[model samples]
Target: MMDMRDIWIVIIALGIGTFAIRFSFLGLMTGRRFPDWTMRLLRYVPVAVMPGLVAPLVVWPAATDGDFDPARIGAALVALLIGAGTRNTLGAIFGGLATLYLLLWLL
Candidate 1:
């Protein structure tokens, strides 16, 4: 179990990290307009970040016996298909959850 001091330390670290990141951005952008190229690139940041973040979790789920799980891959595929088809975030989440649950039940 974590103690109060540990929790305080964690909170302080998170606060400092958040402040530092925000400060850096605000400091850099102060009294200056961003370049068109930078703005255009920022527009695709989400498109790049989302796949980079989700791809790993889908490809490399933890296994029961210390091995990679294939079920996550299938569920992620189903989720991606549903999201692409419907263009809906909730649809993708529900589709993924249902696929994972059904697979878990079957296995």
Candidate 2:
């Protein structure tokens, strides 16, 4: 029961804000090189971000009422092992999913 005009205004404002933030970085950092430390730190961004994004799903999945599931935990561990051993993201994801489904079926 909210006003459509208010929603539109908020959407427009968010769009403008997102564009400005991205433009600020792309416009100003066009040719400059980041420092060595900054570059190294940025290299770990994926490692940090991927886990942060997926940890919640693994730990407290919606279907389980936030209860701990051994199947999920085991599958997560197997996925980590596969990822670490192979250094392949897609392989790890597929392995994790396969393990999860197999475990779910059996347990």
Candidate 3:
């Protein structure tokens, strides 16, 4: 068991590390320009990250004990279709949520 003092030390250390990381981006990079290639790659960061963040949850949801869920898969497909067809993020999210709820209710 960790003592309260040890917990506080860990918390403070993590906070400082996080702050330093953010400050390195904002403070250290002030007035600096990234290479064109870097900028272009950065623009796709969200596109690359979203799937990584969501794929595991959809593929093996904890609620299903890491099993695949059909409703979740359907929702992901609907969201992908909506987003790709209309290029509307919010619409895709709402469409996905609606599909998920409808499928869950029906199944």
Candidate 4:
């Protein structure tokens, strides 16, 4: 068994490490400007991240025990269509959530 003091020490160390890692970027990049190439690359950050984050949930939802659910897939499709058609993130989110809840209630 581990000692309580040792567990608390580890927790404090992890907290300090996380804070330092996050603060290091802010401290170093404050008032700094990046090159055009770097700025352009950074602009694609959201484009790269959103799909990676959302794709798995659409394909296999946790609520459905990692099985494919038509309702979840349908909601993703509706969100995609709304986003592509209207080019609105908020609208897409609202449409997706509404579709998910409606389908869940129905199915």
Instruction: Answer with 2 or 4, whichever has the higher lDDT.
Output: 2
Q: Kindly list the per-residue Cα lDDT of model 1 for residues 6-53, writing each as its tens digit.
A: 999999999999999989987778899999999998887766776788
lDDT of 4 by residue, 79-105 (tens): 899988998878988999999999999
Clashing pairs in 4: none
Scored by lDDT, model 1 comes in at: 0.82
TM-score (C-alpha, index-matched) for candidate 4: 0.74
Q: Of the candidates numbered 2 and 3, which has the greater lDDT value?
A: 3
Error of 1 at 40 (Å): 3.3
lDDT of each: 0.82, 0.90, 0.91, 0.89
Summarize candidate 3's per-residue lDDT along 28-86 as a digit string, tens digits: 98899988999999988877787888889899898899887999999999999998999
After the best TM-score superposition of candidate 1, give how far the Cα of residue 16 lies from its true spot, in angstroms.
2.5
Models, CA RMSD each: 3.5, 2.4, 2.2, 2.9
Off by over 4 Å in 1: 1-7, 26-36, 63-66
| Candidate number with the higher TM-score (2 or 4) | 2
Q: Could you say which candidate leads in lDDT?
A: 3
User: Candidate 4, overall lDDT?
Assistant: 0.89
TM-score of each prediction: 0.64, 0.76, 0.80, 0.74
